[model samples]
Structures are given as C-alpha cells and as structure tokens.
Target: MSLEVLQVSKQYGTQLAVDQVSFSARPGQVLGFLGPNGAGKSTTMKVAAGYILPDAGDVLIDGISILTHPIEASRQIGYLPEHNPLYMEMYVVEFLLFVAGLYQLHGAEARQRVAGVIHDCGLEKEQHKRIGALSKGYRQRVGLAKALVHDPKVIILDEPTTGLDPNQLVEIRALIRKVSQYKTVILSTHIMQEVEAVCDEVVIIHEGKLVAQDSLKALKQNTTEVVFVLETQEEMQSKWFDDLLGLAKCHLISPTTIRLEAKEVFLLRTELMQVLNSHGLTLISLRQEERSLEHVFYELTAPRYNV
Candidate 1:
C-alpha cells in the first residue's frame, strides 16, 4: 500500500470531526472520499497531509508514520486543499516556482518543474496573469499546478472540481485520471457522478465515522434491491400460478403497476395474471428499476454516529 491510515480521529473540544477511519491506497488507483458537507472529509484529508494532528491514531505513508516524520510524509503527499487557496497577487508561474522552491528545487530544475506543470495543468495562457485576474476555472488549475509541481507520489485533492464549468470539469478530471497512472490519488467530493467518473474504489464517512469502504460496484451489490410500484390487477395474479411461483423477491406497487426483476418479469406477469383473474385483479403496467450510486451514497451516510 502506498498510504495507510489506522484508526484516525480528530476532535475540536466536544465535537469529534473524524472517528477511527482507516483505509489504504496504492499507485495506479484513485480512492474517492465521499460524504456530505461537514462530514469530516476535509478534516481527514488535512490530517493525512499532516496539516493538522489527529487526536488519536496514525497516518502512514509507505510504512512511515507521519506524526514522527512530518517532512518526509509531506514530501510524499501533494495536497490541494478544499478552498484551493493561492496568493491572488502572484502570477501562476511565480506561484509554481515558489512551491517548487519549497520542495528544494532551484535554478534550471525549478524553472523546468514550474513550466512542466503549467502545461500539464492547462495553465499556459494564464501563466503570466495574476491569480486574482484569472477566472475561477483557471485559478483552480493554478492550485492544481502548484500541487503537481513537486512531483509527489500521493495526491490529495479536496473538492477539486468545485466552481468549474462543465468543460473545465471534464478537462481537470482527465488530468487527474492521467496522473493516476503513476501515483495514488485521493479525491473528496459530494458529486456522486465524479466518483464513478474517476475513482477505482470509494471510502465513505458519516458523522465522523467510517460507514463504507468498497468498490462502487460492490457497495451497490450489498444494498437491498427492491422495485416498488402499484399493485396490479387481481386476475393477472392467478394465471400461470404454478409456472410463476418461485420468485426470491417481488414487490407490488399501487393497484395498477408491478415492479419486478428483469428475469422474473415474464414469469411474474404470467403468474400474476392468473392470480389476478382468480381474484378479479387487473394488470396495468410493469417496469424495472435499478439502484444508483446517489441512492447508495445517501443510504450509507444517512445515519448519525454521535462521536
């Protein structure tokens, strides 16, 4: 694993912002850190970056505990904070150079590093403009450029896509996806669609506690699957009674529609027809509904844990 967090928690007075959350990530994988606003996603990322100390537990990078070696851990992790802060008075290229200098690069090497990121992050045109003069999308690119200039192995981005236009969102997402080829990327976002767009696995926190950690597909599989609709006709429920008999799960909606699995649809309709005919029920319609990530996100994060 490139990174590991063991039982981490953060408390501000009586309020616990993060509680015993643990997970791992390696190069070539993007982990989505998902939760609602104020759900400790930012706190967790800050702790991982060594910007804030956890009240308990450990954060490690490549087997080295960050608490004991903040500099080494920081050298390995590139963090773009939730706000994407940049000095409004500084030009994009100048800011990149400053960040590069912090990483100990100098002379030609520093200039090359800054230039590489300017192109890599699509900040070429805005490179000479003061950050305060750039549009929100361009400014976000500068924030990302600074994070990438040092070539860190672990990238931690908090709501990296916020305030971006649709085209900019796609562009930035592509950039992140490309970088995942050689580094571990941890992204925090409430946009469920972005999770599907780039992340390989997802770790969800709710009320300062870990609630889910799994592949998106795996999470969906574990959630209950039920189709709900109006109850169909009585006569439809009686036909093919024996043939349509064994369904593992089925749900009836209001008195005219039926919701069922695709495999069971035909059999269910036949059997339901028989049952309906016997009981004077009439069938109106039937349909299929599959669960979505939005539903699963809500389900996992809905419960409150009073940490």
Candidate 2:
C-alpha cells in the first residue's frame, strides 16, 4: 500500500508542531522521516496513522483518507510509536495474541500469524517471557512483531532504534530492510547513518516545516559543495594543501587523513593529485565521501540545532 501526507499541519496550544508538511512512502521501499528533536516527525506520523487529527490537510492510505475512512485506513497501517507501548506484565506471545484479537484474527489463523511474526521478528527465544523481563532490544522486537501481526501493508516506525546497542542496532536495521521488501516502511529517526543504511527515499523536517525530500542518492549530491577524505601513507601538515584550487577548508581528522571541502569536487580532485605529486606524498586514498545526509541535515537544520 502507498502512504501519502498532503499539506498536513498540526498545532499544540501555542506551538505549531507541524506546518503544511507533506511526503510519501511506497511499497518495497523504506522512506526515512528525519528531523531534529521537536521537528514534528512524530506528529506527522501520528496524523497519517489516524491516532490524531491534523489541524489542516489529510493523509491517504492507498488513496483512502485516514480522516474520511478511519477504520479502513487504520486497518492498513501498523504503527510502532517512539515509546513502543507494550503491556509489561504480559508474555510476549500473549501480548501479540491479544493484539491480533483486537483486529479480529481468530482461532488457527491468529495462532499461525503470531507464530510466524514471532519467528520473523526473532522473538522465538523470548516469546514465553513477560515483556518486563526482556531487554530494550528484545522489547523492540516484540513491538515490531505487534506491528506486523496484523499484516498491515504500511509500517510506520518512530525512532525505533533510539537506545539500542551497536549489535542490536544492526539487527534491527537488517530486520527493517528485510520487512520493507513487501511493505511500505516509513522510518522516523534523527540518525543520518540509519537513513544511509536502509532508506530509499528521505524527507527532512526542520522547526515544524518540510525542508527537503528526495531519493537518497539524489539528496546525497544535492548540495552545491562536496567533501572528500584524503588519506596519505605519510602524515601530512595542513599547510601542504595551502593555495589548493578552490579549497574552502581543510581539517586533520587523523594522522594520515585530512578532510577537504570545495565547491566543485572535480576541481579539488584534479588539484589534489598535483599537490600530492609536488610534495612527493604517496596518496593512500583520495575519494569523495558517499555520505551526504549528515551534511545536508546540519546545513538545513543548523539554526535549531547549532543555536
């Protein structure tokens, strides 16, 4: 199923949490919703999930408006909120079964789907344990299982990897990638690496406004300038790059690594070769970094964050 938010806006008392923000998600792809804290990502997802009504505009699930057809639209979405509300006293299996029942999945089908989801989410080892006993990572798995039990076409996740360890983070990222094959996954996060790791498309918000949205590859090279990481076999002084063609700035990131920024990457790369040859320095690696969301994010949202 496809999910589309059109000119959606929301307000809380005196603060405008979201202002005419719009974006989309398609099946078989992961669309990342990114923003600084309080940028209204959660608010937009909530409106799309039908948990709350928008002050203006609408959300459509497969062309079905969440506002006009709340029940039908909700039936098509599986949302895992930032906090991941779960009954701590309930066993993992029991909680999933309870959730399945809410959607009217009964008898053999409920049991089968619960079993399948447990296995899919890698919750088999901890299925019989109470939710309170599971660590945060496993708890997250259980929450994901809950979201999938209904077999919804669109899965909306809000900061699902917030507090995971590195190992758990990788596992969850893999699971997200695995699930997106047949489901429209809208993942909300502040971590740029997470977006780089799994997202096909990106939507960035800043101060409750939509700032940028595009394919991950397109957004990566969208900025006017590009950064290159130059590493040498021998440690070099920053002054060696002085008067380099259109070199905006240079910083020593490591003994053998220097980060360079320029308006035109081609010019910088060409001059870098000449400069290295002039210094008799053997270049280990000099390549344009593929990472872009970090630079794009801070550039667009710096006012709210860097203040």
Candidate 3:
C-alpha cells in the first residue's frame, strides 16, 4: 500500500488546521508524523483517513482519491484516531463484532479474524471485559484490535501510545513493529523516541505545514556527525581542543570533546588525527558518536532562521 497526501489543507471557520502539506509513504515503511502539540499532526492523519475532508487538495491511496471513493479508500485504511471512541456498554468481543459488521464481515470469517487480532494485541486476558471496566492500556489494545479487525493494507495511528504505563507502551510499540512488517504504517506522535524506535522515515510538520522529511541519519548530520572525545594528560582547561574549533563546521561540545560536521568524513577523520598528532596531543579516546534521533528532532523542529 502507498499513501500520498498532495498539497492538502484544512480549515475550520477562520483557522487553518493544515497548510498545503504533501508527502508519501510506502508499504514496509513507517512514516512517523511528528510535531509539537497542536502542530496539525492529528488533523493531517484524520484528513488522510477520510474522517475529515481537506478544504483544499486531496489524499490518495494507491492512486485513488478518498473524496471520490470514500468506501474503497477506507477499505484499504485502518485508522486509530488520537481519541479512540468505544461504546462503554459493549464487551470487548461485542465491540469488535459491531465494528466487523460495519466492514461487512460476518460468520466464521469475522470470528477467526477477531480471535487472531485479539491474540496479537494481547487482549485475551480482557476479552470478556466491558470497555468501561477495562484499564487505559486495555482500552488502547481494544482500539488497535478494532483497527486490525479488517486487515487493511494501510494503518494510520494517531498517538497510539498516549496515556499508557511504561510497560504497556513497550508492549504496544512492539506490536506495532510486528504489524508494520506487512503494511504501510503512518504513525503520528509528538513523542520523538517513538519515531526512533520503529520508523523508517519521518515527516515533520510545524504550524500546519510540512517542514522537514528525511531518514533520521541524514537529519542528525545537519548539525554534526562526528562526536570526538579527547582526553589528554593536560587539564580540561587546556586550549588544545579549543584550537581545533577553528576547523570548519566543528563545534566545541565540551572541554574534552567536539562534534565535527565534515563534508568528507573519512578524509576529515584522517586529517583530524594528523592535526592532533601535530599538536603533540595524545588521543586517549576517539570515536564517531552514534547518530541520535533526539538531536535530529531538535534540529528539525527548531525555528527556522532562528525565527
């Protein structure tokens, strides 16, 4: 499954919720929709799922517009909105049955699928529990089970991990990763770590517009890729590392370390060692830092042109 949002925008009265955002995701990949609170991430996901129409532009799944073919589009999509709704009076199995009916599933087919997803989502322990009686974690699992009941090719999840305990979060995240093996997943969240955990790509929105889209590795290099830790016999205050700050794109991260944003990393690494040797500095420790997603998030979300 492939999802494409083309120049989409949404407005309510005078407020624009999404501003001409465009992106695409493919099967076997999780495109992490990320932004701060009220950054239009949820609105974008809702629009893509056809729950909300865009005032301008269109959402396409496999080249079919949701507006022209809502049912067909929805048939290919399974959406778990930020606030999942459940009939409190319905038991876990009953709610799924009701949802299955909407998708025209019945008889043994529905029962088999419901059983499969219930097991996959870890809802077996609470299968007989009513929605109102279950804990928040179980409610979330129920929501996910409902989404999976139809076995759609595309899954759009909005803040799926919100309001869960740490253990629940880990379990749900693992389930999501397991499911993504066969489907296209568009996961919207304000949490940065979620993207780092399972996402293959990232689409960052800000103030109702698409700002940055890239793999996490490329984004980290926007600031610096090389994390150099040098501990010499000299005191921390020694100017040895300070002098190396004159190197292009080098940042002094600490008294003993600096991060280098070199254009040619391999050449720079060799040259850097030579420079250290020339300075009569004994390099006690030197290694490229593992690129981190937290650093990438900060750079991509930070105000452009310093605001």
Best-fitting candidate, measured by TM-score? 2
Error of 2 at 68 (Å): 1.0
Worst 10 residues of 2 by lDDT: 298-307
* Tens-place lDDT digits, model 3, residues 231-264: 5543243233334533434434455444454334
Write down the lDDT of every candidate, Cα atoms only.
Answer: 0.80, 0.89, 0.80
Candidate 2 lDDT score at position 276: 82
Residue 233 in candidate 1, Cα distance off native in Å: 22
**lDDT for position 291 in model 3:** 53
Model 1 spans > 4 angstroms off: 222-225, 229-288, 303-307
Tell me each candidate's TM-score. 0.80, 0.81, 0.78
Candidate ordering by lDDT (highest first): 2, 3, 1
Superposition error at 218 for model 3 (Å): 2.4
How would you encode candidate 2's per-residue C-alpha lDDT over 275-303 as one tens digit per residue?
78887888888778644779778667764
Query: Can you tell me which runs of candidate 3 are displaced by over 4 Å?
Result: 222-291, 303-307
